[model samples]
Target: DPPLPRDVWLASTEVFLARGSAGSSDGLTLVAKGGHNGEHHNHNDVGSFLVAVDGVPVIVDAGRPTYTAATFGPDRYDIWTMQSAWHNVPVVRGRTQPAGRDATARGATAEIGDDASTFTADLAAAYPDAGLDHWRRRARLDRVAGRVEIDDAWRFADDAPTGDDTLLHLLVAGDVRLETGGARVIPEGGARPVRLRWPEDVAATAEVRHLDDPMLTEVWGGHLTRLALPLASRTQLQVTVELDTPIEDSP
Candidate 1:
């Protein structure tokens, strides 16, 4: 079958909520579900939440069990990837700290510290009604490209560091629109066929087009593209073409 159109928004949503969460009113609560045998590894059972506190929304998860409240002081947010059960575990909205090196060697680790007493004191002084559970929501946006070339750097609002071979989801706020030419769909191996194309005036050894029919959404066929170069940490990348456009509603 021919590859379907790409849905950039849905892909972003998957990336945004890749970490699970538990619903809460004032604060967000994340729970890691799975057997505590300390033997097997499981990613599907974990969950997270984005809590709104003092007008600052933060994400909380139970993925990094090796970390403690002490590891994260009072103030500052951070993103970390830890080695747990032989997997690179991603922990968002946590504390930050300096470390020598990771013993697991699975991935990079990040830490953020928050002075419990000082943080509480500041919150209490500013918003008397604000409690520890009070947190704000975070604004996130993302996008994916299949074959086009990008010029700018990609920025991650969250403190998570960007690295080569890191699978990412580009999230956007509302619907998006884009245009492209000379696109085609092709299937790889046993996986679903993908949309592909070549630019009109670009010279390259291989074809360069957006990946159509990304498995995430039905909007723009969920185009998937790769980075020509590694994305810089906390930097925004410029896209020359509309690889993954957004749609408010789809048929």
Candidate 2:
């Protein structure tokens, strides 16, 4: 018998980036995924993110029901939960990433640290059908600063026509307040709040879509909010979501 190493090793999913655990750092964690849409149990989602704190899910995935005969069949994308529009990603024009292995992200890089982490993925190939020439998403998590930042940069093909057609989606539970250039989301049971700050100079709008499904309402209560970040008037965009810890009252 051989002596075992003190620290256990882990393998990669080849498509995701993460930090902390459900309860680590007082229940704080950050996750970002980049991959092809043709994966098993796949959702047409690339360059998406999930964040949780204090065992509370702030930004999350949508209602996924029990699987049946049709879950894995050709009708997978028919489910709302498995569609790109329902995910936490930017929508280019009125198009969503296609359902194919060739619809993938590229040049993925991650820099992990004790107090900070950064991830970058090129998502242009994921939306070739949209006439996308180049698209990139970068995520930066600052534990000390209690913030998660997302920067999306994209451009259309040289010969393709250009128009401002873009929207960014962020799904959350609990109380929410939508402002002109940003939004505030507080998780249920009164956990820390997440503050979203986007470019105000660009024309933007926010809307909430309330879910009516029984199971979904059991978790998220009413609905989720999607941010329509103006993408037609520019070639690059940046969005930041800051975590605001509740102020404890002194006895």
Candidate 3:
């Protein structure tokens, strides 16, 4: 048999199925069946193939895109795995131009297991003005993936206007046991009324509340509130803490 065309080599799948080009559009369709005769619950065997018309070969399917990208090379082609529902597979598309941008925003069908930061950075580079709040929110959600226990400690500047109720939202994505402890206070008021708003999706396993003495009475007071959130997949834990004291006027 004569050597397959470059396009054929880049676009064809090993699975024996009906493969053909759509003609007008630069897309290929591949139909996979369980057996050679294309019978036996074959409805679940269906999948779509997408190829970018550019000189390079970029393909998307139901599996991981990294495998395709590596096989094709970054210079020659790219692949994306589309999110699917039931037997109908959806191949997500992300703009390959503009260099770097989050694949999710552009409808990336593939998921990055461990390189969330790098992926987010790439998306940011691709779309300079792309608001990263969504990515940031997702990153925070991704952190609580495996174990049931979660321990996070960080300091946030309480610089919001006093008397103006402000809410800090913390979204936890996975199921986890949480323990929170911190100090926050207003220099003027000894202790401001701060409340913890647990995410409706998550369960509050335990909570420990404590108020520490004002560290800097001259500048601003600080108080801390901590709680634990237990959640499951697709479950979100939102903690809304409020600061209810008037911010001291600057001298």
Write down the TM-score of every candidate. Answer: 0.17, 0.83, 0.19
CA lDDT scores, all candidates in order: 0.22, 0.71, 0.23
* 1-251: candidate 3 lDDT, tens digit per residue: 43322212212222221112212221222222111112221211122222221111112122322233444344322221121221111111221212221222221122223311101111122222322222111111121221111111111123212121111212111111342432222212233322234445444443222223232212221322222333223212233223334447799
Candidate 2 Cα errors over 4 Å, as ranges: 1-12, 15-28, 159-162, 245-251
Reference-based lDDT, residue 39, model 1: 21
Q: By summed lDDT, which 10 consecutive residues of candidate 3 come out lowest?
A: 115-124
Ranking by lDDT: 2, 3, 1
Q: Residues 217-244, candidate 1, lDDT per residue (tens digit)? A: 2322333222122232423332222222
**Of the candidates shown, which would achieve the greatest lDDT relative to the real structure?**
2
What's the true lDDT of residue 166 in model 3?
Answer: 13
